[model samples]
Target chain A: MALTQEHIQQRLTEKFGDLVSNFETPYGMLSFEAPKDQNLKVLQFLYDEADLNFQFMTDLTAVNYPDKPGRELAVVYHLHNLRDNVRIRFTVYSDINSPDVFTASKLFSAANWMERETYDFFGVNFVGHENLKRILNVDEMDYFPLRKEYPLEERTRIDKDDQMFGRG
Target chain B: MTEHHQHHIKLPEGSIEKQTTTLNVGPTHPATHGVFQNIMELDGEQIVSTEQTVGYIHRAFEKLAERRPLYQITTLTDRLNYCSSPLNNMGWHLTCEKLLGVQTPKRVDYLRIIIMELSRISDHLICNSIMGVDTGAYTGFMYIMQYRELIYEIYEEICGSRLTTNIGRIGGFERNFTNTAFTKLEKFLKEYPAALRELENLFTRNRIFMERTIGTGPISAERALNYGFTGPNLRAAGVDYDVRVHSPYSSYEDFDFKVPVGKTGDSYDRFLVRNEEMWQSLSILNQAYKKVQEFKGAEAEVFHADVPEYYLPKKEDVYTKMESLIWHFKIVMGEVDMPKGEVYHSIEAGNGELGFYLVSDGGRTPFRLHFRRPSFIYYQAYPELVIGGMLSDAIVVMSSLNLIAGELDA
Candidate 1:
């Protein structure tokens, strides 16, 4: 049977004391918002101490909400522990100007590119990453494309005279 | 700890530094399988370091979904994993249906299972055939490609498009399974096993093929789990976690098939797992075809798919019925209402568990739609798989891993 949101919340409360702030969206997924400072520690506890061993980081991406101050960007992490067949969502919010968070690549090597992708798309700087660079787009591109404010159609077309190799 | 990246981070001063050459593998390369570019810093065929630059094929699908209605997203999903678009289409539609609390009829569920299983077979054929070609066994590749062509012919007979088949709508199939589809599929099922056996014999026994793949890129079950590997990649590591068996979506619980696993998680093991899975899929297909045939000539009840707002109308009745016409107009104009909710629906895709995470705000267009792509997850373990193996072995291992560039980049 799938883990009910209530069961998940009870389990979290039993394990983490008061660290977890739980909110249930109308959609049925339990959202657990933890402090950005205790992100890695809370994850370690969730994996090791509690049996919520979400060993697999299925996805790691970020969302940008510029209008919301103090919560301008959220680094969303989706985890699935195949052993118990349970899934969870862990999120850490950061400010827009200097969005830096600890890298989970230390815990799961699979987070290497996921963190880089989060960095590439949402511009959330992962502080302890060994190498963080653009993975999907050209490295020379100036801005994060997935951010809500990024202009998609502002790119100017190069003229024939400006082309170095001439028009095809 | 930092040996792989030291050369880029450190620099000796004004001394004449040697400038190494850079090789761009693809924005187009045969081995790449699609438009993906990898900028590699090469020291005479030994890669010092590599940077994979993807998204050349990113169609801004999220933006497109934002502009289009919920049901229209099915047409767009066909482009994501064209090799197995039916699975994606079903996943996307099921997510919406689940949000709407709609239950499809048993017949529709059976039809979905048949299409998705066939799609899985078609995808595995391509992955295994590509592995064969990468290992210099062209005969095996040709044989399986021929089988895949037959599968495509069946797909064409059913959906009108062989590759980009928008086979399913939001609630049920776009239309009922046609007679031509069943006949062609029955013929293919009869011949496909022999073709697969021939290809397996040709490649699995060849000494060169075995030598190239046997020990290349071996992964332990624990390591695979840590790396977030799923599907054949994980199954090859001795994990008995097939989504079809465990999650059992689309009435998959009704089928009887074995989840083939391997002791050693290597390229060779991956090959064995996929080959055996094709057999299991064939059995499942046979059963589905039988069940579908059993439902022939029944009085087609008014299509009970709950969300009439999203699913397409029947071509026969849309012209004559005023209510159908009005519903069609409402669907086209995005005036039909949907409840505000979110849903995550997944299925056993050819590669692994393909999930569609959808958020709807009672609007025609989805507020957010996220794809959990198997290739994207598997590719994260690429360096670990590729580093210890030789360059030639890297290519073979990559093929066996079935990392589709379209799904990865999207």
Candidate 2:
């Protein structure tokens, strides 16, 4: 039988039971959220299962929600099954204070740099990653640039006044 | 007491301690072709281990996208892969159209197809010729660069810019293709194939070139998939997956073409795969041009969608008409609100899958935008690829991968 979104969802719900929640089919793709600690278990199950083989890590990124107090960061994983050509998105949320998610670098080698990028931008600390330092930004950067806390433009520039640019 | 303790330090017998010298290839080497640094630990001419450092040209495009309006962000996409800027422009436009729920006409899609394939040809030409140049053959590089000049002329005729072409609008092109553009494209189509054949004869079977590239940097199919390789690189590893075939966005399903594959994912295989793809692109271009010419009288002039709120108005209409003036002002100022949703759309860029993962909250700009650049993902495996190979092989591998610094660091 060809793998469908419902089959994948059903398998996930059966394996993890109530651990996986927030099931959604946004734009005809299966998306769901898991606990931050259970990320590796979910990824391993998805990789090992014959009927639900999503081995290809298409993309890995994070979105910051400053308003959500307990869950301020969401790490999204896009996995693809080459045999079936089906894609599913898995997400895990963590608090901003102690944002530690298990690394998938051991399973998917592509996750090494992507996880480092996520850590560099959003400060999502992948616990077991071998080299979880900054990937893109300069080594001297003190703050995570992609988080919602910082403003887009530099506030320290003295040459241009805000009144001249119509901001004031 | 210290002198007595250091009196007899024993050395192991017959240990031929060899020194491995560390070399920094570039943030600006001629053969690097981009601003990227490769730190290699070398034992004589062979690389013992390698480390890569990118982001020298990083401008943080994703962060910039949050502050700019939708139309203004197209300029960012152009800089990502400047060699094939039209592809990035078209990919972003398609994503926005999906969000706006706009359906483009068949003629518009065909025109886009023609320009995209031309860009693909130009991109592959640069990659293949540069590979030749790296291997100490300058004739083929000079021979093929002239065709890229022709392709750039076609781009100029369409968008008034050659390299960083912010060519098309959200719904469609800014204007219809001129007769002069078509004439130039015709001339290109007639001449490029012979130049391509000549280029192939120079390197495909040449003994030295084959020895340099055939098994220089090899990646298996399973490993390539695990490392998130796509486009020509992945296809060269014997995986027949293509975004055009798998996802079928932007009327690619209507066209008929073959996805080429190679058994061994080596430098030579990558070169062959890209060469075969250029032929397929030419075939697609021919078909698209024929289909575009079939549109009749009034239909032929329709370049953009009918949605005035999203598409920009002409300068004359904006000056004279009332509604056009207001719409122009609103669009330029980005006062029009977008829908509340998230969408991920990808296109098969010259390098790989160039994806736009957008999250909007019905605001003037995106809440979050992530550009899934293929170069960023593929460059991750470079250190592992060149670890045990010769130093010369490292240069060849880098050229074959065709890492664009802008895309890599974006």
For model 2, residues B12-100, the per-residue Cα lDDT tens digits are 98676879999999999998999999999999999998889988998989998986668988999999988899999999999999888
Clashing pairs in 2: none
> CA shift at A164, candidate 2, in angstroms?
11
lDDT of 1 by residue, B1-410 (tens): 65564446455686656676687877788777777766666655555656666778777675566546666787888887788988888888778778877788777887788788889999988888888889887877766777788888877776778888887776786666666877888888999989988878877888998999999888999888877788899999999988787667778888888999998899999999999999999999999877766664562432236566677677767899988988887776566666876566677888887877666667666656667788887777766776534567767877888877778877
Docking quality class, candidate 1: acceptable
Model 1, span A1-168: residue lDDT tens: 555667767877776667778555545455687767778886776667445666777777776666689988888777776767766778789988879899888888778878887888778899899989977777898888777676434547444332332211
TM-score of chain A of each: 0.81, 0.92
**Could you tell me which residue pairs clash in candidate 1?**
none
Against the unseen true structure, what C-alpha lDDT does each candidate score? Answer: 0.77, 0.91
Q: Is the docking of candidate 2 incorrect, acceptable, medium or high quality?
A: medium
Q: What is the per-residue lDDT of model 2 for residues A1-168, given as tens digits with 9 covering 90 to 100?
A: 889888898999999999999998766678999999999999999999999999999999999989899899999999999899998889999999999999999999999999999999999999999999998898889999999888777879878674553334
